[model samples]
Target: MADDLLLGIDVGTTNIKALVFTTGGALAASASVATPTERPHPGWAEHDPHTLWQAVVAVIRRALASIDDLRRVRGLAVASVGEAGVLVGAGGEPLTPIIAWYDQRSAPYAQRWKTHDDPLETFRATGMLAAPIFGIFKLQWLRDYEPEGYAAATTWLHVADYIAFRLCGARTTDYSLASRSMLFDLRARRWSESLIDRAGLRGDLLPELVVSGTRIGAVTPEAAAETGLAPGTVVGAGGHDHVCGALAANVRRAGDCLDSMGTAEAVFLPLDDIPLDERLFIANVSSWTHVTFGAHVARDRYYVMDGLFSSGAAVEWMRRLAAPGASFDEAAAEVETLAASAPPGSMGVLFLPHLAAGERGAFVGLTTSSGRAALARAVYEGLAFEWRHMLDTIEGMLGVRARTIRAIGGGTRLPVWLGIKAHVLGRPIQVLDMDESVALGAALLGGIAAGVYHSEDEAVNALQIRERTVAPDVALHALYERIYREAFLRLAPTLAPVHTALNDLEMI
Candidate 1:
């Protein structure tokens, strides 16, 4: 059984990756392909379901090619971005494209829903903040704009659920993924019939919900032939990518937190039960089910989550503007060299990373001597400041401080940024050895379904997770505490009216 392998497929915003790992947590092989996002109209984004399926197949086959004996692969599962999903027809074809989770095209629908319903009631039932990023709003958009497709659809499946359905012909969704739909009841752990009826959606449009790691079915012959997977290999359920990453990082307790910094960054903290307090709704924090059950240490747990829309995206934008034509490594090196030479706090420069609609990023207090390095450092500091502010809000609302914060994803590669974050937060950060935590978490679930591990703890113990702590600099932390309290904390409130005025002009 030492040779037994598990496969985890991650359907991310930028790429789709298939990672094969041994039961003991050593990676065996991996392959990745760009995730194609089509923008047919401004402010709208989508993924062609067929094209996505093809990419998944390609990555699976490409990764498995390195293995000597395919029989050693015992099980597979999928994890993906939440909220974005495709509606499927009765004949098992996608009725509509998978709408990108960040698409703003559904904003009008979300606004209409907010006008008709009490947002507090909705938040109480769904544990969501009633945003356009939720699946229910996307469904409403499709219902009105693409009536034929909406009428013909039999079920709606999240990205990971759709991939699993394609592999094994099962129509099911896990609780963690379903929690993002804005149609699920958080306390009842089921789709809300009242909300569905109020939204005028079909009663049966959603799939049956199950806990993560459940073995839905085996890989079908057709899928096996296409992807080089063994026929009848167990296919287990997976959940939202961030939740899976938390699982891999062992962030399963009340005080443990996972800082998943990728294209978008999420701060996830598990809770023992759902909090229906109005403070969470006001703070824009979401309460949702964890992707855990059945012998897991965090079984039947809930989590409070929130995030910045553009964390790594802001860094990538800076790379394009400041280090054009430079490789990412080259740009990163430049940033490191310049930042180290420059003073802390980027020499009085401050950046506000609001690169979304209605607001633009700004670099205030820049002097004639400020250069690209200073600008890059300011960006990192700005992000850290924002995260500290967010954490403060979360802790204030929940009355629970994050005892241990584990950092994961692409941003952890930047040592300077990690140090800045540690100083800004005035807390030590634990950086994990594993980069592919999301995929690894899904693979662990697959291992569970295959009987390779008896429980989540066993799977995690096998990995023997290694981490290094990034402790804060006391002197830098003291300085950052003052700057954050005085200037950075006031930026958003002072700029809100200006942003609103600009948005008004754009509308006109």
Candidate 2:
């Protein structure tokens, strides 16, 4: 029983990681490698599928090397960044490079779709905003720019699906990943026929969809040889990396929320049913099927998700700008020390963290006395305020407040940031001790597929989750409450005109 192991491979934008865990939820071994992204042209980002596969293989082999018996590994699954996918040919070869989700090369196609289609109708069907990040737009980009490859492609597989296919020889995808494609019918839980027709894509371009945690197939001999996994090891369906991480954190019930802090941050709040509010669309909040399902969790559950494009990214940017050549930990430590010295409101300085296209980040009310400490503190406060804004918007639309906010990912390593977020939000932030929640969620799914656990509830119950709560500081909370409402909330609207003017200047 102790020998039974589950392997979870997470294909992230930053790194590819393989983690092994026992059925009882204790970590056994792990390995990771940086994910290589190619920027062939400005605004274009892609990953060679072959290179990604090799990285996955290398991590898997390296992780399994610590185990005594390969056959003890019962099941494996993969969780990956959503919306990025590769087109596969009839013979299981990649027809096109995997497009990065954040790439803006498909903007024209997305804009065209927005012009032609009713956005409300699109939102009702897909529960996502019209963005170039969606897989459908990337497919459109391929259809127009690389017609030959698009024509030859038989199936489009999400990053996780592609890796799983390579491992188990299955051409299938899971619902949570499919939801990110912007081609799925959220209510019907299938591909939207009208959207597929509108996009000028073959209806069959997508693969068969399965729920996350469903057993798909077993690792083939070829895959076993490449990854040091036992041949015939059961393979399970996995979902989007964020959803998988949420699952591991046990944010499955209605009213439960997860703040996934990474290169980009997202706030996930699971709901019992879809909210038919147009305001959610306007706010850029997405409602989609969560990785949660079964008799344990609500079967008809969805989640409202939105966040800052630059939560942790803003901090990283500051680190690079102010503490060049310093390691991340070193920079973070300096930031923590400096930020702690600054007062609750960052010494009257305000940071508007809008790092997206057409928007510029700014530090207002800066004086000669303002130093890196106040500037860094302002960045942290700004990130917290932005998340508060997003959460407030979601709460207003949903008519429900999150009862619990669980924090996960790299950003949680920053104690000062966590404390600032807690104080700013006026709520306790539960930081999970699990370092790799996404991979652990994948492992839990693998456990289900391998029959090591009977259900999602049982699999989750097996996890040894330990958490410490960062309670809000009362005095700091009051100070942040006033600052957030007065300064931080107005910062965006105040800078909108300037951002537009700057964009126009760039164009001229």
Candidate 3:
């Protein structure tokens, strides 16, 4: 009985990460490999599926190499960024570059669905509004725009399912990742034939759906050779990155929310019922077996997620403009110090923080009086304000005040930003110590499959713990309330016009 370790792999937006953890949730070793995206045309982002698999294999190999015990690994689990889609031939050879979730090339196809006035019904059925963020839209785009590629495809796979198929020879998707495809029926928990036909998607393209803890298959000998893990290690179907991160943060039930601060920042609230507010829109963040065993979350209990899609992106953009030559850590540190010097409002400079298109949180005002520090502070404030707006809407829907908000991911590295978030949201922020919660959450799925844990709650209780809590300063929170109100007032009316103009400019 070798001391078993669970291995988890994640194929992320800009990096591939592999983590090994004990059943007790202690990280033994980890490795990361940078994976770059290609934009061959405007509004299009892609990565060769082969490139992603190689990256995953490299990171896993590195992680295994770092550890002295090779036979101790019990099982493997995979979690990947959802919505990026890969087309595969009957034999599993790549037929097209993966159209990533961040890719906007599918916007026209998504727009067509809206034009047909068919999105709402689909939303009601699937629990997700059709958008370019979904893999199904990209599949439709391939069918329409790249007829040659579509004709050659036999399977349309989400990034995680594709990787699982390649490594384990199982074309299986977990409940969470499957829910990201708008063609999936949340109530039925399967691909909706009607939705598929309506979207002009081939129903046969989808893989069979499985629950999170189900063992899909064993890693192939070839994958084992490439990754240096034990042959025939069980591969458990994991979940979407955000959902896994939520699990890692211990947000498995109603009233618990998670803030994942990465390239994008989002606040995910798991509800026992679809929140009842007209102002807040419900989209399926990720779906899994309900919090309780043998029980499914009713259509009402689905996850409602709202995001500042450009929040962290805005921060990175400001960092580059403010500290061009500094490392990310150095730049974060500089911004932290400079932001501290500026007042709560950044001296009346309101930044909408919409550096990226197709998302909200646009920065509004800039003047000569606004120094780099002011801009930095405005960037931070804009993100905080964006969160505040979303949280307000969520509370309005939930009709209750949330007590503490759970925060996770790399951005929590900065206390200054966390403090600002606390002040702006007017809630205590509990920061989880694990930065790679997504990978850990995927590993938790492996633990469940390997029979190390009997239930999700038990697994979470044995593993997840809050590391620190940040209480908002009264004065700062008061000042931020005023600033955030004014900032929203100044920016709200401008959103439609600015977005329209941006669309026009992009078209021209």
RMSD of candidate 1 to true structure, Å: 2.9
Question: Rank order by lDDT, top first?
Answer: 1, 2, 3
The best candidate in terms of TM-score? 1
Tens-place lDDT per residue, model 1, 388-460, is 8777767777788999999999889889889999999999999998888899999988888788888888887
Off by over 4 Å in 1: 279-298, 357-359
Candidate 3 residue spans exceeding 4 A from truth: 275-301, 357-362, 464-466
Cα lDDT of candidate 3 equals 0.75
Count the clashes in each prediction: 0, 0, 13
Backbone clash pairs for candidate 2 read none
Candidate 2 vs 3: which has more TM-score: 2
Compared to the true structure, candidate 2 yields what TM-score?
0.95
- The lDDT of model 1 is 0.85
lDDT tens per residue, model 3, 15-50: 789999887678899999887678898767789888
Worst 10 residues of 3 by lDDT: 287-296
Q: Each candidate's lDDT (Cα)?
A: 0.85, 0.84, 0.75
Which residue segments of model 2 deviate by more than 4 Å? 277-300, 356-359
